[model samples]
Target chain A: MPFTGKVLVCEEKVHLRRLLSLIVKSLGQHVLFEAADGEETLLLYQSVKPDLVLLDVNMRQRDGIQTIQALKQIDPDCLVVILTSLVNHLTAEECLRLGAADCLRKDLPREEIAVQLARIIDACFGDIPA
Target chain B: MNVSDQPSPMDLKGRKILVVDDDRLNTRIIRGILRPQGYEVADADSGEAALAAYPQFLPDLVLLDVVLPGLNGFETCRRFKSLYGDACAPIIFITARSESEDVVEGLAAGGVDYLPKPFRAKEALARIRTHLQNRLLLEQLSKANAAKNRLLGMAAHDLRNPLASIRGLTEFLRDGTVGPLSTDQLDLVNNIHDASQSMLELVNELLDVSVIEAGELKINRAPVSLTALIEKAVYLNNINATQKHTRIVLQTCDLPQPYLVDAQKIKQVLDNLLSNAVKFSPSGSTITVRMEAGANGCSVSVRDQGPGIPKDEQHKLFKDFGRTSVRPTGGEKSTGLGLAICRKIMEAHRGTISAANHPDGGCEFQITLPS
Candidate 1:
């Protein structure tokens, strides 16, 4: 079956946010919230409690690391996956340590993105019906 | 002054020299020898006087006597070094003793050269000239390297944002998110997307080269299946190969599984070789990949049926920006850094990458990794 849960996309770029929103919708998921920075992401996370959060590492005011920390504080078991163009090993490791589910590159192909998202969805819920 | 004995015009123009000796006769001899060569010579009778004169004299070079009344030459040299740090001028010690132990002690004390007390003027001048020239060359080299790194950083930082935007917008249009498009429009948009993606890859490759040159490229080694890595690389390059009607054939062999290596970096090496094979092979040609296990290690070769590299130009294949006479059969754009990056990765892994012309009629690029 299709995913019936909410997702929050926290990216600073408008075009990237729209593209990600489209990809999530195409994968049969609902994007309930969108955030441009860490402060907005934390505020949205408090109210929406999205099943998944796709966060970018580079953001204005606050960054993905701080935001992930705040999100984890709100809910210890929150699922946040980093989506960024910066291919830094240290940042990826730190994000994982801060309770991120995974760190995915923004330059990944659409098919790969869909497959990764589907895998994440499967882990959250049971296997989708054939 | 005899014409033959006169120093050359460029020998000592605007050069400053400081001579330190407890004997006034020795100091006078040094001044008399260097002053005619157009050098501004300053003399001191003791090590303490030399240290005091160092600040105001600011000589380009120092001639120090080993036997001083106070703060012997070795101690004076050490003190000057600590005070000047990197800017410390080259110091030549003047000693009456020519024993090996004395020379060693002088060198250990930070003196770059040792001049016997009865030193000839020509020899002293020659040593000074050589050291000054070497220092100048070193400074120039370091400055050039810093400037190059700065330029690379700015390019990587500035070019990535616009390129990503272009790629994102092109993908949006091509995916029909904006609207439906004609077949030709779709193809054009696809080409635009490919071009932008290639530009992004070039920028990333340049950044990798800079990182490698700066000795910061790190590899996380683990057990990885070679077969799986090769297959993944072939799959990644399948689209480009198909565009040119070229087929990549992977020849499997019974090799050990889960070799210790950096999976991501090895995959990069494979991807670069396969892509190069595809770019240089003619349409409807076959590219072969073969792997074998030997005593030294495992070797993987990618052979292409294209115009082989010329003998004279083969040495330059793995060098940075090394472009051979053989051009890409398909009008593909290359960063000219792919092979160089591959070489660096292989070296980091204690492996080797080499290219040779196949006897039958093509070029073969091989990578050998320690098992």
Candidate 2:
């Protein structure tokens, strides 16, 4: 299997961030970055420039919508996937309109999340790394 | 006016009542009839005075007489409705005439009820008590409904995050990502993962039910192949069937290729039927899924080689939290919400689901969708 690119897991909860990091690391040989809030996510996006950002929709400051907007400004091609506990179609549609790759429910199985992230990564980066 | 008995303290306590009558003697009689029952009474000799006192009095009910010095009862009731809308208190018109036209006109003008004059204290009190009780019940129901929605929202938001974390961490540990684990530890981790998965399923079902009840579930309809959908549902449930040593076989006869439907919702219906079949069938039993196209539409049925549903319990099959005498053969967890959700989905798709006892002796669940 070829090396997948870097991923940034942005969530307010420490345990969730750790779990996501572990899942991404287990996916393949991939670099991982962590951010506890949208502010941290924006700051880290500049230095890390990860291929994908898993952003939590209900963060303390600068929630998922704001973070996605700022990330798009920084890099038009940046792939941001929303992580939310509530499965709301309206919120997902709004996130997609704001340039999010997808909005995923947090309650989904880890394997399913991994599969979705892999698909998004493949679509964004293709087989050959950029 | 002879007051036979004092009104029940329970019936009239804490109620504010406004009595509008041009006759001061009538107002005095009403106060004598109500004040002893722990009621707060306000007297207005004319419709004009009633209107002036209503805002300040904030009464729970009003007794308005039609023959007032100014602004008669019907017109006063209409103005009261305009002022307070549905929030206006219940008004019982006190009139001298019992003519149907007068009653109809009073009702049309926003009076909830009418009392014929030469007022019998007992009848008047009885009507007042009934209306107040009904209004109280309606208020309580509305409040309870609002609270239920709030609780549902909070549960959908707060419960899933922890459940996701637990499932993820358990899977992480089970996969031996951090280090090797003993067989015992691995089994424990697997159990935790399964429990979390079941909880997640329950939460999702509850969320779906709430959304459907709120009429917020949106279905994106398209032409979807019924063959492909059944194959996918069977594939998804293969592991579940295998665990219970059950085999699922799909049989189709003159089935339509594709139907205009919401693919995701139909898939959910299929998944629910397949899961129920697998959950109830004995080990080594065969479950056959048959699809047939008819003049009206197409139907898919899953027949399980287990106990047939009780004839008496058939009507309860599609209701929320409906359970039957048959138990899950594989000790699988069921929230008793799967069939309810399936029924709701089918209703949304303009389809139908039914259950019956097959002649060969088992329960068969069927779903029919328009072609």
The native-contact fraction of candidate 1 is 0.09
B1-371 in candidate 2: lDDT tens per residue? 13654233344488899999989888898888888878899988888899999999999899988777779888999999999998899999988755667788889999999988777889888898888876776666667766775677568667777888898998889878899999999999999988888888787777777677667677898888888889889988978899888889988676666688888988888998998999889999999999888899988999998988989888878887788777888778888778988998898888899999999888899898876
| Per-residue lDDT of B73 in model 2 | 83
In order, candidate lDDTs are: 0.84, 0.84
Write out the backbone clash pairs for model 1: A1-A129
lDDT of 1 at B283: 91
Can you list the residue pairs that collide in candidate 2? none
DockQ, candidate 2, comes to 0.56
Whole-structure CA lDDT of model 2 = 0.84
> Least lDDT summed over 10 consecutive residues: which range in candidate 2 chain B?
B1-10
The residue ranges of model 2 lying beyond 4 angstroms of the native Cα positions read A1-5, A72-79, A88-92, A101-105, A127-130, B1-132, B135-139, B358-360
Q: Count the backbone clashes (under 3 Å) in each candidate.
A: 1, 0
Find the candidate with the highest DockQ and give its number.
Answer: 2
lDDT of 1 by residue, B1-371 (tens): 47895434444466788899989888888888888878898888888999999999988889998888879999999999889987887899997855667788889989899888687889987887777665555566777887786688568756775677678778878888779999999999999999889988888888888778778778899988998899888887888899999989989787788898999899999999999999999999999999999878899999999988999998888988888877898788887889999999999999999999999998999999997
